[model samples]
Target chain A: MPVITQRLRVTARLTELARVRQFVHGCALREGLPERETFACELAADEAFVNIVVHAYGGESDGPVFVRCRGVANGLLISFVDEGMAWDPTPPSAPPWESTETEITVGGLGRLIIHRAMDGVRFTRRGNRNILSMCKFRPGFSPAE
Target chain B: MEVKITEYKRVAVVQPVGRVDSNTSAEFEAELRRLVESGRTNLVLDLSKIDFLSSAGLRVIVSTMKSTRKNGGNVCVAAANARAAEVMKLAGLDSVIDMHPSREAAVASF
Candidate 1:
């Protein structure tokens, strides 16, 4: 399969969130990803993008966010790059679907959804930019869940 | 978010259409809360029309549920698609509130 990568740069604003989802949805569909898988990627990407706007840029609309969609074997990778405040590269550890027996709160759910929706997620800080990447694979082809 | 609220005898069904994200969650939350303040506390949130559910919207759902419950009211959700349902589950919000498959069922649950 041919590997293709696409990129988009948008201002860090809540209003830009839909455009970001549309960009990724179009790319994921063109890659022939199933609707469910495509939606999962969209949700994961939205969570990451929102975090960039809300946390990285502190809800400011002036900062820039770089979004990328890359095609890989049996899956796709969605990544975000932002020059907002430097954040530690720790992926959230929201418990899996079964063992979560804690009280539900309104806050801190954005990262939890991102960590759970995608097959794998990674974070890194390079120079002054914070990078987050989420990977999702087609069913039956996904490795080890 | 475009909200369509149908008030029943005891409960009201509030169906919000379109994406409920950071940009529109405030309006959505306001609409839901308005119904409560207007003496309609028991509510059924019909999510059949919501295309996307974000954390901002989830927070509104949670806070609304918490607030209403504290006031002897309750919120039930209806017609959430697979992905939306999964998002609620991931947030651990689904287990706390009532969930039904259809708007009528949810309203009748009151």
Candidate 2:
């Protein structure tokens, strides 16, 4: 079967987060992705979009966030490209689940979540645009040797 | 976000319909913070109506919980869907707060 793909583009406004969630969730469910994994994609994608708006663009509402979700070999790829400042979001480690005021308030918590909620996260800067991609693999599937 | 607060003698159950993401988290936080400041600190968050949740929403909860705890109060979760539950669990929130199967259970815990 050919891999199916869905894409959406929206301004870097907080109001646009809902559209990103629906767009990503709809694509996952339509492709028969499991419920657990479906939610993961929805969240990971949302986190990335928020990161772009809050971090990449400094809370600016007009910056455009280019989103593209496509089915790949044994997994789904949710990618975002934007013309915002370059900052790779790959987290070194997930914050301790301690829920302390210092831990959550110091920042990088969202990055930890985006990493833990998805199977893979990759980042690259292409000239002026930043490309951040996250992957969620199908159950009982593993990359071939 | 539309947040409904059902007040009881011991606890206030806050139900928010729709998504609690970056856009709406501020509103959600405001409602809960209002309750906390009003001395209604023990809170039961009925999340059944919540369609989606993110770190922004979780941040509000954590901060609110901290505030309530400072006043010898606490917060519990009610009817959180699997998605909401999973995210909370991922954050190790289950260790810090209680998550009940229903609003009744959540309120009863207080």
Candidate 3:
């Protein structure tokens, strides 16, 4: 099967979250990922994109953000590159999902879920840029149908 | 996501339709809190209309579920499609909350 790869440029705004999701899902579909895997792809994309909008830009404002998806020999690789102030999401930490009501606050839970849903997630500080990547294997076929 | 609240007797069932993402979760947050503040603790979310759910939406549901439980009430989800159901299961919410195949079953769980 031919590998599928694509890139999407989006404004660093929360509204573009859907656009990002569409792009990722489109890539996954071409890669023959299942519906469940497609959902996982969308969820991972949502969390990473939201982190960019909310934290990378400090919710203040930022320039264009680039989301690139490339199908490799084994799976899909999604990279999010932003020009916002550099921050690494490598050291993941968040309150437990089963924590008490007070600890179950809505804050920082997005990243946690992303970590759980994706096979591999990494954050890098390239100069003054923040680059986040998430990878998941192509489970059989069609990530989004 | 689009949220519509329907009143069943004294209970309020919040239905969030479409994919719940960062852009759409605020609407859910507002509507869910509104139902709770209005003393509609006996709540059920009709996920039948929801085709997809993101972590942001899950966060809202989990938080509300915790709050509802603390208030001596409950929040259940009904008729979640495959996409929504998979995420709920991955998040382990399927175990904590009552998930039904239909709204009637979810409402009856209260």
Most lDDT-accurate candidate: 2
Model 1 chain A scores worst on lDDT over the 10 consecutive residues at A95-104
Return the lDDT, model 1, position B107.
Answer: 77
DockQ of 1: 0.45
List, residue by residue over B15-106, the lDDT tens digit for candidate 1.
88888887888999889879878878798988888888888888787777766776789888999888778778877778877889998889
Clashing pairs in 2: none
**Per-residue CA lDDT of candidate 3, range B1-110, in tens?**
67888898756788888878777878888899888887778888888788778777888887788777788888888888887887787676788788989988888776
* Candidate 3, residue A67: how far the Cα is off, in Å: 0.8
Residues A41-138, candidate 2, lDDT per residue (tens digit)? 99988888888887889785798898988987676888999999987586646444454552255236677788889988899999989999888998
DockQ of each: 0.45, 0.49, 0.52
Error of 2 at A63 (Å): 2.1
Q: For model 1, which pairs clash?
A: none
List runs of model 1 lying over 4 Å from the truth. A88-107
For model 2, residues B61-83, the per-residue Cα lDDT tens digits are 88888889889999999999887
Per-model CA lDDT versus the true structure: 0.81, 0.84, 0.79
Model 3, stretches more than 4 Å misplaced?
A: A1-4, A88-95, A98-107, A140-145
- In candidate 3 the C-alpha lDDT for residue B9 amounts to 77
Candidates 1 and 2 compared by lDDT, better number = 2
